[model samples]
Target: MTEGGRRTAEPLPTEMELLADLSRLYKIQPATALWRAVEIREVLKAGLPTGRGLDLGCGDGALTGMILRYAGERPELDGLDYDHGEVRVAERRGVYRRTFCSGSEDMPLEDSSVDFVFSNSVLEHLTHLDATIAECARIIRPGGNLIATVPAPAFQTLLKAQGRTGAAREAYVTTMNARLAHKNYLDAAGWAALLSKHGFAGCSATPYFNRAQVERWEKLSAMTAGVLQKLGATNALLYRMQRLTRSDDRSAGGLLETNRGIARWSRHWARIVAGGVLDNPGTDDRYGCLLVSARKP
Candidate 1:
């Protein structure tokens, strides 16, 4: 992963800078996509491929374009995602040479077509990770790189459930996972094993986004999404209501982004963390996320 999180030749980005970039083009008032900037910066420092590459799970192609521009490398790239609407948006952006609207587990592409693949914060939410990883192994050429940013097991510990101990923390972790739609939160060794099982070798996982940074994101999430999760058992009515009422899936940025007041406040929050460092104090064993890298064998 770069030698260390903060030890790079490039200037460390402030929270406002990231927020501005995300919010700019009518996006985040400093949305949770701050996480994307965190992952992208570290990935850039680690050196990504600039040849035939794939942006796996690319959403709207905006973030992928941002990462490439930031890195000063314009690799010939193709994007893949399941959402037809999103794939249309990505196609309109002119970012990818080719775009596929398909699920990760069953991608529509040639074998060994790309030298490298980059996925940002996409793998953890998959219910079928093995299938997706196996597909990645198939598409990337031998010795080609597969780089991704994913949630680490430490992610649960880094949440705002700080003072809670034992079962309380465990419950919070479980509830948060349900609310966040996260299925896998593997550590370095677990990820290496999974990659190896799918014909990937030389796997390395570098955890990033330290405690304070993640806590800030969590607090922001809590304020916006609330503490209560709509886990279907008891809140079935509310869940059903939400499913019926929430039609803003096609909105820019997010569902809340369409709200005037919410957009204003979100922008305000984006500016509050002016000099917030992306990876402060550097990534340690306790960091919340991982930048995993591997090679097709």
Candidate 2:
């Protein structure tokens, strides 16, 4: 049985295998990559139909590669990202049939052309949320699905509930907003309504990365990155190490032997354990992240 208590028709990648794939991105941001891998695994477990799918805001294309690994085959996928450097790296990864450097607010594709589309942690960063979702609705054909994982509004709630008050709360909010660069945060109902307004139907959302798990990620990420910086190690150095050592599925073990690798491994293990307990199937309505889906109608 899967973590959700549902029988898997085919097993998802072993945690190690998923980590190995994420090692491609761990070089970029170790803590973020590891935690996002958790959310990606949960989203892919839904087993959506894949054909000529587009990965909107596909940073480094690593998450899309993880989806392909989960499906056990490629499915005529293409990726889009606004960062020129990230797009170049994604092309080098060669996971997608093509990679484009363009904002999600305006896709270059024709309307009613794609089978499905998905994004991971992308929509929250865009200021023009309506324009972007409209573009997503425009490109997908009738009956095609838009599956994305986004930061839910409960993140803000949990942040406020941290017992800070007065100037402390203000400072915390300011720091988090600056650090996260999120332009949009909404609950499931808000997302469903937005999608419905843009020609989608059957909008549904499931929560993941509950409050406790999110807190762990924040604490562990700060601790790990802080230690690495104090030791004069940078994400650049870790990326180089990963590039040199990551040839296949065994990369996680190889990295675990080093100090930086240990930091990453610690974060990964903490995430897995915390997620298993807090974000398991049939959790409460509040979540740090929302895995949402809608169909073009």
Candidate 3:
């Protein structure tokens, strides 16, 4: 698969394939999440959760299903979501053996019941982040891991802020934060400290989503889901798109023509959109996301 140590002329990375796959089911979602699934997969290559895993903040179970499917790892999973409405939808996917509808600050689970808690891009949005972290600490068995991914410092300084300065820059950051429902950006150090304070041990964070990718995602987002998001139609759109996936499952032969066409275009879209910046980000001076993990102790 490699002429040299580098992957110069090999098949396109799984990330591209994943991007296309997500395009089918999550067309209305920000494309950034599709890009993130692969990076998260890469980050967790060291060790994925095993035995009694929990999908903390699992939305509709779609993203979690795609991520785990690509990772080729399927452990019995439980899901928890703040919205009872969303949890109802997630329960139908059968990805999670059990689903709980509850707030993160007060999860409904027995103490020390799960082996690992996997939260993807969820912690930063929690208003009671400390309390939620404490709950994660409490529910995870001793030595179990809390694996999460959150925005990094570069999220505030996205390449979109290239020309802005002074007050303008601050305003742009504020607007971006408000759009994302984020209170503050937390780099690897901040997350490590928080996990440690919550009695987690050997905390480590790996940064991903390089600057160029974030910029590309921003552009793709405007073309894909930006308008729906602006019109507050995201939930309704998600319902419709999710129906297509469910319908495909019940069909006899294969994916419907609609889904097939979407899949093809999505693959082509991946090719063009990722043409220049498709290289794997081995290291970066700047990145937009952090993959943080720590063991409860």
* Tens digits of lDDT, candidate 3, 50-97: 689899999878778766664434578999998765687787778899
TM-score of each candidate structure, all chains considered together: 0.81, 0.77, 0.81
Note the Cα lDDT for every prediction shown. Answer: 0.72, 0.70, 0.71
Ten-residue stretch with the least lDDT total in model 2: 244-253
Let me know the TM-score candidate 1 reaches against the reference structure: 0.81
Instruction: Quote the positional error of residue 210 for candidate 3 in Å.
Output: 0.9
The worst-scoring run of ten residues by lDDT in candidate 3 lies at 1-10
Q: Please report how far candidate 2 places residue 170 from its true position, in Å.
A: 3.3
Return the clash pairs for model 2, or none.
none
Query: Can you list the residue pairs that collide in candidate 1?
Result: none
- State the local distance difference test value for candidate 1: 0.72
Q: Tens-digit lDDT track for model 2 on 1-297?
A: 443422345777644455555644454354565567668777766665557889899866766776766664446878899977567768877888888889888898889888899888889989889999999999998889998888887776656425789888877766565456777888889998999899899998888876665665566555655456558766566445544433332423445335576556644553343444333443455678888889998
C-alpha RMSD of candidate 2 = 5.4
**What lDDT does candidate 1 reach at residue 93?**
81
* Model 1 Cα lDDT, one tens digit per residue, 172-239: 77877876679988999999999999988999988788777778777665654443343333344333
Off by over 4 Å in 2: 1-9, 13-24, 27-30, 160-163, 224-285
